[model samples]
Target: MDMYTFPFDTQTCTLTLKSSGYSDKELIFADVNNQQSLTTESQQNQTMGEWELLNINASTTQPSNLVFSQHCITYQITIRRKPMLYIINLIFPVFCFLVLDVASFFMNASESEKLGLKVTLLLSISVLLLILNDKLPSTASQMPLIGKST
Candidate 1:
């Protein structure tokens, strides 16, 4: 087939393939470039390719260093919601707070020990938050997420 075009746009010409699978299914992104033994999965799903033109995110102008003879950009795309980072940052601390809240029950009707326990737990969780912050890298070193010491 002839992919004839005068001005090529990388962002426009390139097609994006997105697929969703069960948690167990291995989501793999394969770049079908050059001559190589086609993967068994590809061979099986040959008729069910997952390439799609970036119609919604179409490019306004032609991209630079355009290259042809290439198509079918496959990516294991997974739908995710925002607030993931915020939730993560708060999950541990929030969990600790919840635990402390329950611990408040240990306090008497009106006593110093009860107040002390609550303060102590809050301080402990404060330290934990700092540790978590330090553990997470400032920049994204790898995909998915940065490795946590745990």
Candidate 2:
């Protein structure tokens, strides 16, 4: 499951553990037999991409006796994005190329010089796009906001 926000934001994901053919009555939950301890172990050891763990909350839910269900323990993990370095290192160069392109438009050059400048800018932007395409999230439904803006 991809938990990506379109515009460079952080998100939290909840993971639940439910067993088959097990209920609160059959599988008693106590200080010794509980999921809270497991949750702590998971949070301490688990690592997700580029996101830093902010907090983890774990809780148990006892289902009604009427329906056959397993005891559920929900683990909510909050993560924050670490995108500042990438923006400066990868995206800043693209912005510079864009500015150069815009400046080329205002330059009073000969037809050949202008054509050469346009070609160079196009090639530079194309190379930047190719580099960025690999770094960006391909599974996203829409293009990245930065790419769209530029």
Candidate 3:
């Protein structure tokens, strides 16, 4: 759940299947032909909204304890976000605004016009920051790199 990496981040989620009432002797969990439980169709349906499935690893485990042991099938699913959405919606616009601000300095406008242009650009950037603020959680432990850059 680290958002510090933001658009470049990859998340690994674990899905464990186990029966609480059933022990390993009563119920066993095994992958077909010792292969991953994920089907070909699931692999093909990799893209889930903004996330792109990267890898899936499945394993069976039997926890050793004084009590009855239960069979668990764990799947580690790795997915990376499709950064295009963030790039287009957030980063690109900010970059363009920065470029415009910098280029405004070279414009052959009067001092008053330049000041007004700078003020306008500053307001535009403030509005953009406000929009970004709404998208990110205020309770985050650390600010995201995107936020810092913006």
Cα deviation in Å at residue 10, candidate 2? 0.9
Q: Is candidate 1 or candidate 2 better by TM-score?
A: 2
Model 3: per-residue Cα lDDT at residue 138: 60
Give the 10-residue window scoring lowest on summed lDDT in candidate 1.
1-10
Worst 10 residues of 3 by lDDT: 32-41
TM-scores of all predicted structures: 0.33, 0.71, 0.80
Q: Taking the tens digit of each residue's C-alpha lDDT, what string does model 2 give over 42-99?
A: 6688675677666667777856764776667777777777787568756788778878
Q: Which candidate leads in TM-score?
A: 3
Cα lDDT tens digits for candidate 3, 1-150 = 767888888889999998999877888676644334364546686655878777777888778873988877888888888888778878898899999899997988755788888989999989988887776446556777876745
lDDT of 1 at 59: 19
Q: Write the per-residue lDDT of candidate 1 for residues 1-150, one digit (tens) a residue.
A: 111210121123333553333111344344444322333334454442223222222212222443422222333222122334545675656776888789789768678788788788878877877877774435432333222333
| Candidate 1 segments whose C-alpha is farther than 4 A from its true place | 1-93, 137-150
Candidate 2: residue 71 lDDT (0-100) = 67
Model 1 lDDT, residue 31, Cα: 42
Error of 2 at 80 (Å): 1.5
Candidate 3 C-alpha RMSD relative to the actual structure: 2.8
Q: With candidate 1 superimposed using the best TM-score fit, by how many Å does residue 97's alpha carbon deviate from the native?
A: 3.2
Candidate 2 lDDT: 0.69
Instruction: TM-score winner between 2 and 3, please give it.
Output: 3
